[model samples]
Target: MLFRQVTHDDLGCASYLVGDDAAGIAAVIDPRFEIDVYLDLARYMGVRIEHILETHNHADHVSGHGRLALATGATIHVHRLAAPEYEHEPFDDGWELALGEVVVRALHTPGHRPEHTAFALVDRARGEQPWAVLSGDSLFVGDIARPDLAVDRVEGARGIFRSLHEQLLTLPDSCEVWPGHLGGSMCGGPGMDMKVSSTIGYERAHNPLLREPDVERFVARSLATLGPQPPNFEAIVSLNRGPLLATGVEATPLTPRQVELKKGEGALVVDVRTDQQFDEAHVPGAVCITSLSAGFGSRLAWIADREGEILLVGRDDDDALNAAKLATAVGIRRMAGFLHGGMTSWREEGRPVATIERLAIGDLPARAAAGELQIVDVRERREWDEGHIPGSVHTPYHDIDAIPAGIDPELPIAVLCASGQRAAVGASLLARHGAKHVLHVVGGGVGTWERAGLPIER
Candidate 1:
């Protein structure tokens, strides 16, 4: 059996290319919206992609199954319970598919989603026993899939407990375990290991959820570890299950005047430059979302409307193109155009540019000592609870609109996250909302603050 795991570092998701060399046939599982990787792999491996499989209706990122099927003429398969609106072959429990010497068997593991399935690969050439299992969102290297995505928390947790213990744990200890996600993915708990793959024995011994056999205990622990779900999860799931849309929407170029007009007409202006470049000077009211950030698409999806028009602001056409592709991958399809020559052209044309103040980490002590600065920690709730600057307001970057209620716009406000990227985003939002004094903490975030032996509230 030939196997290759493709990792999307940005989203922390993994896709698979399993094939039989002799048979010249392959299968792709849980692919992202960008299908070029699978096509390129098939061309290089001297194999034909005949089957595209989806473990479940994903809530995080849009699936590429529809596009891959059209490109390779492969049949798309999903669990019968998913009831996907798209045309697909519905496989059920105990269903087995033969690809040359490798047999792909479907195990109905409905927890993360009601129709979630884990595929086991059996190499008939070696033995009847399975060699590995593609545990999609059902199990991870060190953590179990979060069950609250598709169903009620308690109900889904119970289902996940049964699915892991009965179907997955029953596999041979030596069988290799491949999951759908890794570290940085929101599909599971925060304790997920960075490794892309693991063995059944390794997970069985080290996985915290499996250590507790009691269903009640497992459910309680799973519930306690559940973090914030992706902001656009519901909309993403709806798009994944319904008819697939065009993914390669090329960004059109527009003059600064055109961009300004569109912004006035309610189009979202997304500035895809570095945090520093954006902070120095940018189009007023534009949201700062760097094109190179790993979570660029997800972050943009959380703030921008799915159906609203998006006007790209980048360094040049290449930057705009890349940003458009990233936005399309996450199902943000209503891109109007990109600024023709970017901010440089906007500034040269005598258009006004807005600037946000930057605060150095070293100077924070003096500002705090003065008791005049109001600091806002824009990290997640879990991170805030772990440790944060004392008296700092906890407002997540996605929920920056609430600043007016908890903070005074007239006071000097500073924002910080785990890193400086999110703080820049929050600062930009605050400035756009007419905050009198907004500071973007540059050098470092909570990590630097802690390392410097600064006092932490919690």
Candidate 2:
């Protein structure tokens, strides 16, 4: 048996390749968007990838199922409940995939999504003692799965309760549980302890959801505890299953002369800078998306209307190059060029600038001391609990889009993070989402308050 786990640090997600050496047959579970990793592994192991499996339709990074199948002439197998926009084999409950001596038994567990499934591996050559169960999003390491998917949040929560109790919880106490994601993930609540993998027995004793049985209480906790979804989440989901769009491959940096010439060609320029830099002086009609946060690509993808000739106007040439590559990675390819000279060069050419007021950390608690600030802590919930400023509400950076529905745009919004990096990301997302009165806490949560010697809250 050949087993390898691929973990993506940015999203804290996991995918696995389980192969049978004698049979030269292998199966992949929950693969990532980049097809190269899986392809390389299969070739090195001298195995033909015959089956593709998804624990569930992923909501974060797009799956490589469609592309891999097209590349390898393999069969795509998802649970019967999953209705992928593309072609796939619907494996019903109790379906078995035999890869030589390695047999993977499919157990349908619908909690995270209606079509969720967990694969229990049986090394028939050895014994019936199962080695591991690919829990997908249906089960995480320390925390139970998040219930809210594309369906009604309340209904999903209830479904999760039944799924957890009737399906997942019934598994043998010894089955090793390999979940789809880990801690720091926006998918689950901040209660998650471990990040990689755990066993059914371990989770039953430590996992909060498995510990709770009251259906109403379980549903309430699941619904109320989840963080907000990332902006343009539905759009990304649609694109994932849609036809392949190439991220411009190994995009080259553009020069200022090229940007100047292309300005007349209707190239949409995105200025990723601080609000102060943006408001004071910037290219007319340029969108401001900072080079911070995971959602940077997602937001830019949204602002691009999912279609446009994107020209990255970075803080410098390096910024332009990164933006170009990132834009391509997320499936946005219309990168025409970048502002070669940056704003400085643009200014030498008599181009304008914009400035917007930003808040430092000390300025935040001072206003809080004066009862005149709305400090938005956009870090993960666990980070917030560790050491956040007093009176700051925990609103994750990814949830910036949904915040307008509940958060008042009138309140002076000061976005914060453990460090200022993600705060810059959050502030840009909020501002682009149409929140006018927003500021990035530059010194981050700790820096500003420490300098001010303000009353610190644990």
Candidate 3:
């Protein structure tokens, strides 16, 4: 038996390749939309991909099952309850798939989604006992999947409790547990360990959800920890369940003159550059969303109107291509093409550029003390609770579409997030929303401020 875990750190997703060497057949679980990674792995392992399995209809990122099945001639398997629009072999609880000496058994573990399933693997060559379980969105390293995403919070939490206790926890404590997502993913609550895999015994012992015995308590805890849902979540779910649009839509290169014209026509100019580079200079009215950032696609989808056209501004063609691919995964298909030579060319052509003032942590105290700067902490609610600048208003970056009711737009606003990246994005959004003077805190966030022995109000 051969096993490989492919992790997309930017999205906090994990896809698995389980191959039965004896049969030269493999199965991929929860693949991303970019199917090339699985294809490459199959070629290197000298195995034919015979099965593409989805634990459930994904809500966060687009699934690659359709693409992979097309590429490899593999049968796509999902739970019968999913009722996916695309062709699939629907399996029920206890259905087993044979792969030479290995057995893949399905356990209906619905909570994150009604049709969510966890695949238990039995290595017959080693023993009849199952070795590991692909817990999917059912479980994570140190946390369980968030139950509020699919149905009503209480109902979903009840389902999760039953699924964990009746199905997953029944597995032997020694069994290795692999989840569909890791830390930094919004699929689950915070406090997930960075490790991609854990033992059933470890999670059973340490996971807060698993430790709670009462269903009522579990439901309460689960509902309480619900964080921000992914942007375009409903659209993503529909896309994952329906026929996925074909990939490989190459971005058209637009000359500076064309880019300028498109901008005039209200095309959203998204500058996919580093926060520092974006802070230095960028096309006026462009949004900053670094292509490499985790949740880049989700963030872009959240901020930009789904119906609006997107015009990418990257360092070059490759960056633009990457940006487009990420955007498409989250169902952003209305790209107007990329700036031909990027910001450098735009500057060389004497295009108008805008710059945001970046302030270090040291500068924040004096300006804020003088009542000149109104700090807006754009981190999540949990991050704000951990510790934040005293007097700073908490407005999550995703909710920056409208300024909070109490915050006066005339105040010189300084936006800060965990790092400078989100702050840059928030600062740009504030500027677009008619804030007169916006400052991007480049080198400092709440973490930096706390580490610098600055006063923090928890």
TM-score of each: 0.96, 0.76, 0.96
Q: How many clashes in each structure?
A: 0, 13, 0
Q: What TM-score does prediction 3 earn?
A: 0.96
Candidate 2: worst 10 consecutive residues by lDDT? 243-252
Best candidate according to lDDT: 1
> Model 2 compared with the native: what TM-score?
0.76
Backbone clashes in candidate 3 total: 0
User: What are the Cα lDDT values of the candidates?
Assistant: 0.89, 0.71, 0.88
In candidate 1, the residue pairs with backbone N, CA or C atoms under 3 Å apart (3 or more residues apart, or in different chains) clash, namely none
> Each prediction's Cα RMSD?
1.7, 5.3, 1.7
lDDT of 2 by residue, 68-89 (tens): 8878888888886767767778
The alpha-carbon root-mean-square deviation between model 2 and the true structure, to one decimal in Å, is: 5.3
lDDT of 1 by residue, 1-458 (tens): 88999988777899999989889999999988889999999999899999989999999888888888889889999988888888889989999989999999999998899999999999999999889999999999899899888889899999999999899999999999999999888888987988989999999999888999899999999988788888689988898889865356778999999999999999989999998899899999998989877888878887888889999999888888888888876778899899988888899999999888889887887888799799988898988888999888988888876455678989999998977889988888888778878899989898889999999978
Error of 3 at 366 (Å): 1.2
As a whole number from 0 to 100, the lDDT of residue 68 in candidate 3 is 87
Model 2 stretches with alpha carbons more than 4 Å out? 242-253, 257-304, 313-418, 426-439, 446-458
